[model samples]
Target: MKVIIAIDSFKGSISSSEGGAAIAEGIKRVYPDAETVVLPLADGGEGTVEALVSGSSGQLRTASVTGPLGEPVDAIYGIMGDGETAVIEVAAACGLPLVSPERRNPTLTTTRGVGELILDAMERGCRSFVIGLGGSATNDAGIGMLQALGYRFVDDSGHEVGEGGGALARIAQIDASGTRPELTSCTFRVACDVDNPLYGPDGAAYIFAPQKGADAAMVEALDQGLRQYARAAEAHLGHDIAGIPGAGAAGGLGAALVGFLRAELLSGAELVLDSLGIEAQLADAQFVITGEGRLDGQTSRGKAPLGVARLASRHGLPVIALAGSVGSEASALNSQGVSALFPILSGPMTLEAAMDPKATAAHLQGTAEQLFRLIQATAGASS
Candidate 1:
């Protein structure tokens, strides 16, 4: 039997490649002669760079860039095997994890590092970009990133506005004359999953800033700033991006990418799957195995496993999902073409113990072995 393993990272436990390896090991235990193909997968978020790089046999490049708080941080991006496509996750440069809880101020964070990463990749001859817009630590409407790309945000006095979302309200002009000339030749595909607008009750600041350490007052202030920025962007860039779906993602980085970079916002899972050439791998597979850290109702909404299941279903292949933890809403995934769902846990244990990488891999292998045993028995009985 040809079994394809395309599992996502278990998040803090095993990576996508490791998860696939564990599943393959289990399948081997049940069917020693089985042909197994382990394909690493992600949804274009935290593991995007790693997934794309490993899956495509690409190389990872690291650079020193300004962090959300203006500190220097090392950020990594990937160049595909073709050497022309670069995959970047903005979180690598300006994610919330870089800031301590007491210092996690959205009003003060910036996305400057993201621009640096892009520029670095461009300098290395990458003309196409796949940027993952998730886990941001800023609410600046991407002004800091634009600044790094040579777009100046000037106040009424013609002086450049200071960094952070708090300063966006004072912007009076956007000067793009100094922007990198190479940007016009580049094409950007943004990995985005949310549909929030740029500003207002359901917008970036109101909905996401709180998690970035914004209180009620700060949220209001940031929202006003985004509104002001939107007006300036409309007048300067001649695009109405304020109400675009997904514009609020990554603290309005989605809007900036769309308006300024002319990027196409796509479902993160679809982007990752296409980039990895998953369809080609499913052609000869009899059964597919996929999973993630958790399986829930949200899994059907463009998560990696759902994408895998949908693809497998097209080929009439049964998809078995093994999640670290299965939620009450996991049943929703059944309609999405997942033939079966199983938790990797053997029995009740402390969350910490279960999350241990070695323990998690062992659990995955044991669970998969038992599942394959049942499948084999059922097939034998039918024969």
Candidate 2:
């Protein structure tokens, strides 16, 4: 039997690669001769960089770039096995992780560091790029990033707007004469999975600012600042990216990149699936196993496990999933092609205790073993 094991990260515990490894180990326990293939998955969020690097057979390249607050930070990107394409997760530079809890402030944060990374990779000869946009600590609508790329935002006084969102409110004019020339030769795909617009009730500031350490007043201020930035972008770019779906992603970084960098926006899960060549793999697999930190209503809408199951279903393969916790409704996954669902827990345990790396791994191994053994029995009976 051929078994394909694909799992997302357990979140704050084991990585997606580790989770896949454990599932494979369990499959081996029940069918020693079973052929197992491991493909770790991510939904273009926090673990996106590692997942792409691990599953793409990509080489990790590290560079020094500006952090969320202008500090020096080491960021990593991926050059896939083909060696011609590069994958960059913006969070590596502008991520919330780069700022401490006490220091988190969307008004003061910037995505300039992310632009620095993109420029560095382009200079190194990467022509095709996949930029993962998530986990940002900034709400400057990617102006900081564009500034780093040489776009000049000038105030009414003719002085350039300073770094951070606060300065965006002062912008009176914009110029791209100094923008990076290399950008014209590069093709960029922005991996964004959310549908939030740039400035509204469900948009960047109103929805995400508080999480980035913004109080109610700060959220209001950021929202207003973003509205001004969007108008300026429309006036300068001749398009309103702020109204585009997923433009609010990463605190409006998506809109910024779209307006200034001319990037194509795509769903992150779809992008990862295409990059990993999942469509080709499902054709030969007997059974497919996939999972993530949680499986719920959101899983129905292009989440990793859902993407895996959809592909498996296309090939008439049964798809089983595991999760750290299962919430919302199970029926949401039924129509999406999940044949079965497993929570990686033997029994009752605290959230932290249940998510223990070793313990979760053991549970995943055991569950896969049992699941395959049952499949073997069913096949035997049908025979």
Candidate 3:
């Protein structure tokens, strides 16, 4: 049998390649002569840089940049084998995890580091980019990133406004005269999964700010500031992007990418899968195996496993998924192309123990072995 496997990282434990390798070994134990094609997969969040970098034989580069709270942070990005495309995850510089729980205020955070990283990559001769936008710790409508890129957001007195979402409403002017001229020659592809508007009840401030540490009063204030920022950009930049799908992603960073950088926003998982050329891998495969750290209701909403399953299904392949744990809502995956779900845990164990790299690899291998035993028995019965 020719089996195709594409598994995402188990985050904090095994990486995508390690997990797929373990499962591939397990399959070998069952059918020693079987052909197994293993591929890396990710939903385009924390592991995006590692996934794309490793898969495409890219080199990683690190740079010091302003963090969410204005502190200097060392962020990592990748240059693909082509040496012209840079892959970046915005969260590496301004993600929620970088802030302490008590200090996790979106109003005070900034995405300046994202721009710094981009500028550094450009200086390195990378003109093509794939930026992953999620897990941000700001509600600033991307003014901070824009500032780093040479745009000026000034108050009525012509003084530049401060950083963070709190400074949005104080802006009265946006000057693009100083924008890096090199930007005109660059191309950006934004990996964004959310389609929220810039500001409103269902927009970034209301739906996502809460997780970024916005209280009711802060959410209201941030929402208003986002509106002001959008208005200023429309008036001064001549591009109106407040209502564009995904404009609210990463606290309106999507708006900056689209309105100013002319980026094409795409589904994060779809972007990763397409980058990996998954369709071609499925062409001659008889069965596909995919998995991630957790499988839940969110899986159907463009997560990596679902991305793999959907594509495999279209090619008349049955997809089986494995996870470290399965949520109560994981059953929803059945309707979205996953034929079955398998949890790799052998039995009860502590969270930390279950997350051990060696333990996870062993469990993945053992679970695959048992699962394929059933398949082997069924195939024999049919014969």
Per-model root-mean-square deviation over C-alphas: 1.6, 1.9, 2.2
Query: Which segments of candidate 3 are over 4 A away from where they belong?
Result: 373-383
lDDT of 3 by residue, 1-383 (tens): 98998999998999998999999999989999989988778777778888888877888999999999999999999887789999999999898888998999988899999999999999999999999999999999898899999999999999998999999999999999999999999999989988999999989899999999999999999999999998898998687899999999999899989999999999888898888788997898888999899988888777889999999989989999999999989999898899999899989999999999999999999998888889999999999
Top TM-score prediction, candidate number: 1
TM-score of each: 0.96, 0.94, 0.92
Q: How far in Å is the alpha carbon of 1 misplaced in model 3?
A: 4.4
Q: Give me the runs in candidate 2 sitting further than 4 Å from their true place.
A: none
Backbone clash pairs for candidate 1 read none
Per-residue alpha-carbon lDDT of candidate 1 for residues 250-315, written as tens digits (9 for 90 to 100): 999999999999999999998999988889988988899999999998897779899999999999
Cα lDDT computed for each candidate against the true fold: 0.94, 0.85, 0.91
Better by lDDT, candidate 3 or 1: 1
Error of 3 at 279 (Å): 1.1
- Residue 175 deviation, candidate 3, in Å? 1.6
Which TM-score value belongs to model 3?
A: 0.92
Model 2, 232-306: lDDT tens digits are 888998878888998999989889878777788987887877888878877788999998878888788778888
